[model samples]
Target: MYQRILVPVDDSDTSRQALLEATRFCHNQHGKIRLAHVINLAQFTWGGAEFVDVGELQGNLRQSGRTVLEKAAALMQENGVEAETTLIEIWGGTISSAIIEDATNWPADIVVMGSHGWTGLDHLLLGSVAEGVVRHAPVPVLIIPIKRKK
Candidate 1:
């Protein structure tokens, strides 16, 4: 029985699906959930230089991450599952690395997350975070793939 389930969320349909799946799993196992959202401030930095005062941008990103975490936590609560939320700031690493580190440090039994399922040129350009987590996570990771609605 996977008791401690860690879920990483973003503002995406796939993430929503992941949350739903995590909630269902917890409900069945009587487990707890740790919801996390990572804010990658480095994305705002362009060309390896500080182009602007990123303090405000970083603050905004933090707020957004909090919002994402809150919404995920709420979903868990609404499903009658215990949930703890964390907002991770990626000051010096990739988002996937932050998520993997959090999962190891939190010592979760399993990780549930969403996969954008990018392929071909898009996959090469965007580089899948789910792929990174699958490759490096300390625990078993369940990836829920989401398809775009046409």
Candidate 2:
């Protein structure tokens, strides 16, 4: 019984579907869920060093993370699941690292997230956070992937 579920969310449709799935699981299992939104400050600095305002850019990113988390939490509420949320600002390491860290610290029973299911060039270029998590996370991971048509 996975009582504590940690879910990573973004603004993507895949993420929304993952949340919905998690909500259903939680409702069925009487579990709790934590929604996480990560802001990669490490990626931001190099990109912003030349032109963007560091403080403003970071602030905007933080707000965006909050907004995403809020929306996710709302969705959970609508599904009759009360979800806790955290906004993680990572100065280093990949997004997967942040998620895994939280999962360990929170001691979640499992991690539920979304996967874009990119292949070939797209997978090579974008890399897969879900893959990284599946390989390294201490607990079980459930990924809600994009639906394929028959």
> Which stretches in model 2 have alpha-carbon errors above 4 Å?
47-50, 148-150
Give stretches of model 1 more than 4 Å off.
Answer: 45-51, 147-150
Give Cα distance to truth, residue 134, candidate 1, Å.
0.5
Q: Residue 72, candidate 2: how far off, in angstroms? A: 0.4
Worst 10 residues of 2 by lDDT: 41-50
Q: Which candidate is the best by lDDT?
A: 2
TM-score of 2: 0.94
How do the residues 1-150 of candidate 2 rate in per-residue lDDT, one tens digit apiece?
779999999999889999998987789567889999989877667854778778788888899999999999999998889999999899988999999999999989999999999999999999999999999999999999977669
**Residue clash pairs of candidate 2:** none
Please list the C-alpha lDDT of all candidates, in the order they appear. 0.88, 0.91
**Candidate 1: C-alpha lDDT:** 0.88
Q: How many steric overlaps are in each model, in order?
A: 0, 0
**In model 1, where is the ten-residue run with the lowest total lDDT?**
46-55
